[model samples]
Target: MTDLISENLQNKTGLVIDGAMATELEKRGVDTNNDLWSATALIENPEAITAVHKSYFQAGADIAITNTYQANISEFMKMGMTKKEGQDLIIKAVKLANKARVDYFRLLHKEDRDVRAAHPLIAGSVGPYGAYLADGSEYRGDYQLSEKEYFDFHRSRMQLLDKAGVDLFAFETQPNFDETKALAHMLKLDFPDQHAWMSFSIKDPETLCDGTPLQQAIKYFNIFDQISAIGVNCTTLENIEPAIKNIRAVTKKPIVVYPNNGDIYNPETKTWKANRQAETFTDLTPKWLDAGAQLIGGAVEQHPKTYNK
Candidate 1:
């Protein structure tokens, strides 16, 4: 097993770092704007992404997600790139992460730390289709595609990411069972060596959009041995409690939970922001950990200091 997954199995609490937009922002000389997932594909600077990963490492994060959440062909087609071009991005993404790992070890060694002797883990992030797959919206959805098509779409990227040597294969922001099954199967077929984990999104609805109960969804996927953990992210902190509670009822596998900024106060607009005022690293993490969430992280609006705080 890779060190990342092994540590996750050992350390009950694994920290997640999301720096999707770090490269894009640095290229344009801007800070993060939209959700990092979309804003990240704008810039192509692997070095900038590495620096952000380093910051997350310093923040005490055990796992750092590469900035390739939207680096799939279907998503990149919007940017006018061909399928091959988008696929090549994965190789580059892996190299970028390896660079981040090397740099992080160098920094730690300089500070008299032994992180180099220990193993480090890098996760290659796979975000949902730019549109929903179950019930595709007119603009974002492109729902006409069949389930097999969706699976095939993601399959191409999975193959490339597997070759890149990511410690695990991660599917994030999926809202239903169709997505979960399709992705899990593809990963098993192509990247059997890597671990697979799923994260569902919380909308206004009670159950996830695919209509599976939280526990059932996890139970169904647990049949696959490669699933090291199951949890949720990119949603409200309020959702974390219910997610943890439900997921805990089903399986004993490690639980990973990362909530977005929860109820933040906006200075200029005088408004409370969920993603805007999202949870800091310190706030509410203890609640999740105490509540049996084996892993903790910041989803939307995640900063490197989230681990430090």
Candidate 2:
């Protein structure tokens, strides 16, 4: 299997992943107040999803993550969609991002089109099972599931994403260590050709949301060759540097970090509160790179323009 991420990083300082998809879609006037969140656009306003992807690419992102983070089969089915309809929406998410990549390139100058860096990769966003609960269990990581249960919940969506041709999987914002271990095992056993970057939701610099030691969780996957990169996401800006340093201490793989804007999320109300003391991505990107992050981006409330240097 080709290490697509490594190929893209050969001569680059770092790969810039696109900013938040749910919040970006909300800015485009798509109502994301529902459980579907950004995936609601897949049915109500798909073009807005495509437009969001294009905007990120134009903002100079090296990777555009698909908006399937909350678009699992069970969630879509609960909305009165059939099983097949739910699967199609996941595939559509990938297509929209792929179209944005294609359309963005056509808008570039002919001379610039041939450059490797100008071509962006599409990462299929696989959010944690907690995202499907739509009650903010992702941040808590208190849910428990047997290994088979975890694999069964995730396998179909992964198959759909892989069949749709994503460059890689973004097993991101994961909180449970056992759940992630199940996913890693499933990827190596079932989808051997595909690779993914795993980013955890953490409680602090040293602990995962589920109470696992950050270094222990990261070190456990050192033997899984299918995991291409490892780090943290949807955490505080203050946590990025220490998390990256911790990750660097355990593995030589690329470090991917995309923390939330200074705001803090309240899952009960599905709202965010401003944190005046939160550091800006502009003020922190270089520090993250210096701390050994090879791939960087933003989480909630972070707009594409934030990456426009």
Highest TM-score, which number?
2
Give a tens-digit lDDT track for model 2, residues 1-309.
Answer: 788888877877778888888777878888888898888999999999999888877777779999999899998889899999999999999999999999888788865554436347899999999988889989989999999999999999999999999999999999999999999999999999999999999999999999999999999999988899999999888999999999899999999998888788887776678789877787788788888998888743344334322
* lDDT: worst 10-residue window of model 1: 132-141
> Scored by Cα lDDT, where does model 1 land?
0.62
Candidate 2 segments exceeding 4 Å error: 110-119, 299-309
Report the error of model 2 at residue 262, Å: 1.2
What are the clashing pairs of model 2?
Answer: none
- Candidate whose lDDT is highest: 2
